[model samples]
Target chain A: MVKSIHIEKLNYVYQSGTPFSRRALTDVSLDIKTGSYTAIIGHTGSGKSTLLQHLNGLLKPTSGSLTVAGNHITSETKNKELNELRHHVGFVFQFPEAQLFEETVLKDIAFAPKNFGKSDEEAEQVAAKMATLVGLPDSVLDSSPFELSGGQMRRVAIAGVLAMEPQILVLDEPTAGLDPKGRLEMMEMFEQLHQEQHLTIILVTHQMNDVANYADHVVVMENGGLIANSTPERVFSDPDWLHKHHLGLPQTTAFAAKLAKQGVPFETLPLTEKQLAEKLAELMPQSGGELHG
Target chain B: MVVPFVYAFNILNLYFFMFRIMVLLILKTKFERERTMDGIIDIKDLCFRYSQENEKLDLSHVDLHVNEGEWLAVIGHNGSGKSTLAKAIDGLIEPESGEIFVDGQKLTEESLWNIRKKIGMVFQNPDNQFVGADVEGDVAFGLENQGIEREEMHIRVKEALQVVNMQDFAKHEPVRLSGGQKQRVAIAGVLALRPKIVIFDESTSMLDPEGRMQIISLIKQMNREEGFTVISITHDIDEASLADRVVVVDDGKIMGDSLPEELFQKGNELIDLGLDVPYPQRLKFELNKRGIQTPSEYMDEGSMVNWLSRSILKN
Candidate 1:
């Protein structure tokens, strides 16, 4: 598979030369394959957000190098030279709705495309398409973005990013404050995009369930360093390691651990609800009793 | 004449003694009635609207009663008026009709500040609420507001910090703290006021999972050990599950009110209402579909484990 993003020994420091210098990322090197779903899990101040900012040239590495969507970025890279790279990486910030400030939802979604030098007609067309893709109704297109509910406003923000037509979709806790139904819808829409458009997804989330369900690859960060980069199965296999880092397992895996304590054998850890159910069904006796109240 | 006067004096003393006994009995019953009949926080026929043009009220005829020392979680989808109801309790917004009482004091212009002093609220954004440069200063801000004495404020701030386990970060700048640490400071600030009721308005929503867990555990400790009446407005099911009672609000009305265990049994209905179904319920549905029988009642993770161990593993 082609690499969508590659980082080699990336380091970032806040206020580097000054007396109040702080290191945010240290010796971080990782690669995300094109058309793959990757989840970044970490506690706050764990350098995940810093690494994400590095992807879109929002912050340049203090040392080392990175290449996102085939655009090479180094510490010495000029700001003017990174504009082209920005078009290929759609960054959906945490609480992206906070950025919405337009007369209409259509106008808000079209803003990015217009900024990227598309004509009015072209930008509006792309905005309409992206808005529909994000499940926004046609009737809401002309309404004020501020008038919409929190979930709809969020979709408008995401549609704005999608209007840019990026190959890599980077999400920062996209479901942060949404209700469960809204969270599920947002995630499913991303899954559809991943399947239909083959866009590479890089998600930073605190929800382990999302990581288990959507992400094939998991990266665990801690205290300004990348600690683990592996498949979800391998990452979640060590309960003790995860517990020690104050990380949590998916609800399914945590439940499976309880069953393990009760002498249930697991050839492999189940990472999702469906996987756990199937595993338990295979283990139970063929003749199951009726459910009791 | 002296004997007659003495007899009159004795009779007057007996009458006074009987009146005193009658007054004490009446007062005792009134106190008990107030304590037992009314909740610590009570809302009666509360109605509110942001604008008259809107067809529906933001909060319509909502009636809720939060018991003293009860942890009640209010959950709803966005625009469902859960937050509105909470704000009404805090007198942040006046309801168009109906009444709200906190600690038995009616929510009115005259009693608003006194009611506020009895309630402490922790908002979602920690950074927005940080008023002081350092942790200690921020914790003491509330105390300093009511013109608390310097010596008393010092003792209270230290005690509040200790309760939230942020005593070590007393001198740390607000910018230096992580999201969790900042929330702890926010919580410490609330604790310093020593309010009878604490409202967490999506306080843990902005935090990461670990940070969220820390705050949730702290909330539990505050509710259980400190005996604070907790009203947490949230969308997180995990947070709601830990509460003593769950109140479901929909379209500016109370939809359902029950214990966490019972509330989750209506699994698909909850999902339809934009709320999360509990993990155990989901697992139960999956298991039942696979020809495996599980209990119909909602079982928390621990109970589910024990049942599965006894039923399936034992075989």
Candidate 2:
């Protein structure tokens, strides 16, 4: 796996030295293993957003080094080339698609590549291809971006980012307000991209269920500091650790914990529905009676 | 001449008394219905559309009844008119034909302030709702507009902050607070007015699940203590599952309005409508497929597990 994102002792403070000075991030150091799907979980004001901003050079750290794609992002690089790095490290801001301003979805999708000096014909070609990749229908290309459904519009926004074809893709709260199915759909898309393209993914989400199913790495933050960084199973098993940070495991995980406390001899912690079924079946009597109300 | 004058005087006195009684009753109803009293909103056949987008209104013949001190969650896919209906109640937009009464007054600009007096709304985007750049200022903006006296304003602002556990942030800049904290400030602003109903219109939609939980739990606590009517407009059914009653809106009409279990029983339909059919519901649904006769309804995760354990043990 490639080490796509590397941060060393990163620090960021808002309004430093002023009466309102706030340390948004302090001594943050972490490496996002290249090609691994990661989920960053934290309550708001927990420096999750601040950390996200730092990943793409949108916000410079007050101190420490960041090595991304062999580029020293923390160093005062040339302005022209910073844009170049951003192209490779594509970031889709929360509800990014809602900010689309174009006469047609096709035009909106092509806007990014056009800014990068791709010819009109070449940009449209790339946009068309990216549009399909994000699951937007071909007919939507000529349709007004604003006229499409909210879900469709969101896909178009993601397609705009996909047009950039960055090695590392960072999405901030992609499923914040979506319904459960829409959220799952978005996760499926992310999983597919990571599995097929081997694109390094940095997902910032609050849903433990999502992290439980897809994330290879889980980063927990609280009050401007990293609290825990580990795999889902290890972190979720320690209910006390998660509870201390205002985090809760998936409902299923919590249920499994309850069973474990009842002196059930579970082989391992169950994080998914299937695991829960298998674990419970093993403990219960073979002649399972019909479950009643 | 004296007899004729006396008759006229008697008639005039009777008319004046009747007028005063009518005025007193109206004023009395206005104050009581707004202050800590219940059954605030009664809406029927409500269909609203923007004049600019007249052809676009999907909410037609909508019927909803919300009681005082009750929490009702309206959920659906995007563009389901949940937000639009909320705005209509707030008088942000008027329904074309439907009549909405806040404390028994028809929806009209003349009665808008009085209606708004009964309810305060918190929108989806915390940034859009802030009237001031700073935290205290943002919270105070609504109170100031309502012409609350300065001293009373100070007292209420502090009270609202104390309620949401955001008292220490009275002077902090809005940008300094996290999204959840910012929403807490937003809720405080609405709370300061002491409105009978505080409508949260997807207020936590922009937050992470952790922040979403914080916001919802805060509202739940407030509902238990303060007894305000909570009407939440959301797309997340899981969050909606915690409400008193779940109303599923599809297309432009409500397809189902019942307890969470009733809608969940319509399993595939709920899924087709783009709802996740909550965790406990999903578990029960799968169990039923496996020939398990679960109870009529399982209230929550803990209860579901408890019921399963008991049933298995009994059997």
Candidate 3:
């Protein structure tokens, strides 16, 4: 029951004291368990990104407090004092490929580690290991990152973050802009990391299917406030609330709901395609092609 | 006798020249007919390569025709050359071989600027498209580039903003707008140009779910109401499902071209092309595996719901 991250009454206002001042997050509170996969879902400007920025001390809370990976942060926290916290919290920004700038893929991946005081040789070694972990071939390690394809560039950016060997990995729409196959592969890589490497994952995504399939816990945000914090099943059980917030249900959950309205018996909603298939199979006849459309 | 033979050879040469001219005239008419076959954009065996070292052409002998007022969705995995085809159509990059015709005008160096005016492209990143200080300024940037008068630019910019429902944010800076609003502003920029065709190059890929829906609806409105032909290049199957025709590109070639409903039915082929099968189709596949027979034809969410309810009620 170790809490990897805990936020209490966190508030953030952008451009405070100016005419353009706006409150991004208002007294939000949440807890993320260590080694647990958590998905954050909300509309744009819902303070999801603002809250994520606070996890690694990218943005300090205007009021209240947060403790992430044993590092305490508040408005009083200085930029220079956040080095230790950042080491344990890795952030993969949206369109991360745009962030790659090194001449070679290996150099780009090794940049973060070398910046954190690792020797050149040590950083390169770690970078190579992380690159392979992210499915990047060694042949391209010496090549310019700009020469790689979009999907490969994304992997290099991810390997750069993984080179830090952080305990908590935060991803902001990591699969955005990728093809369906690439999206699936990227999601699977993160899942493998979460299960095998035991890394705590916090993902901000618009994809409900990713939430239902991968996340154990879900957090919902609306208008700069925390609305719901619970398991995926509890959060998605009521479709009305999600729709009201301009959110959507996972395909399987939505399909199950449609079936439920037609007098199909269900103890609980199926969250995944496999679960839906199993549930429908029990009610169906063993013979194939017997029922008329 | 030899003088008469030379005279006959000269006469034969004249006949051959006349026959060649006649054939050329016929081919010219046929080519023009194909270019104007109600296709606003026609690409014929287009081939392009990024560099000499590139082993395969970025766009390899690709032939695609987009009908007037049609919403065409081009989908492919990363580096599959779907974007290259779009760039070729826009004249952003010159192809190594083959021809492209937009609005029946061939795309060449001489016609590049004129053809560009007819096609407006919204790229993946809205931030990159911004060239002005505020929303209104951004929308008017294109018109300004064309030497439009200030008063006329103002009217058109306002109208474009009103169409995207971004009129209220006319004074808002790009930094202040949400992702969806930024995209709307980008669309307004395209709309002010009054282009015949609008290319959404993975425009919704950077947006959230609600933002994506808003942009998609706006594109649909433009295509249906305003009579603008749409060419959307995307990776989202759901978005592609909304198009009138879906073209699957794999490895610099068109793998499948059909209606979205018919295309989704080829489940394994879509997966092989690095695309996704729609949710309803995936559900059908899962059900069929467990000895429950589902229809072979593709079913969207609504039809799938109806079929599921009907079958379960029968049992």
Alpha-carbon local distance difference test for all models = 0.92, 0.80, 0.90
For every model in order, the fraction of real contacts preserved is 0.86, 0.41, 0.83
Predicted structure 3: lDDT: 0.90
How should the candidates be ordered by DockQ, best one leading?
Answer: 1, 3, 2
Task: Find the number of clashing residue pairs for candidate 3.
Answer: 0
Model 3, range B104-198, lDDT digits (tens) per residue?
89999999999999999999988788899989999999999999999999999999999999999999889878788899999999999999999
lDDT value for candidate 1?
0.92
Model 1 lDDT at residue B25: 97
Better of 1 and 2 by DockQ: 1
User: In CAPRI terms, where does candidate 3 land?
Assistant: acceptable
Structure candidate 1, residue pairs in collision: none
Model 1 chain B, poorest ten-residue lDDT window?
A: B306-315
lDDT of 1 by residue, B1-315 (tens): 799999999999999999999999999999998895699988999999998898889998988998998999998887788889888999999799999988878899999999998899998988899999899999999999899999999999999999999999999999989898999999999999999999999999888777898999999999999999999998778889889999989999999999988888898888765568888889989988888887666788889888877777666
* Model 2, span B99-174: residue lDDT tens: 8887667889899988898898888887777777777788889988988899998898899999988999898998
What is the Cα-based lDDT of residue A258 in candidate 3?
Answer: 87
Of the true interface contacts, the fraction found in model 1 is 0.86
Ranked candidates, highest lDDT first: 1, 3, 2
Candidate maximizing DockQ: 1
Q: Which sections of candidate 2 miss by over 4 Å?
A: A9-27, A60-63, A74-76, A222-225, A288-293, B1-39, B51-56, B208-211, B221-224, B236-239, B272-275, B285-296, B310-315
DockQ, per-model, please? 0.66, 0.32, 0.47
Candidate 2 chain A lowest-lDDT run of ten: A284-293
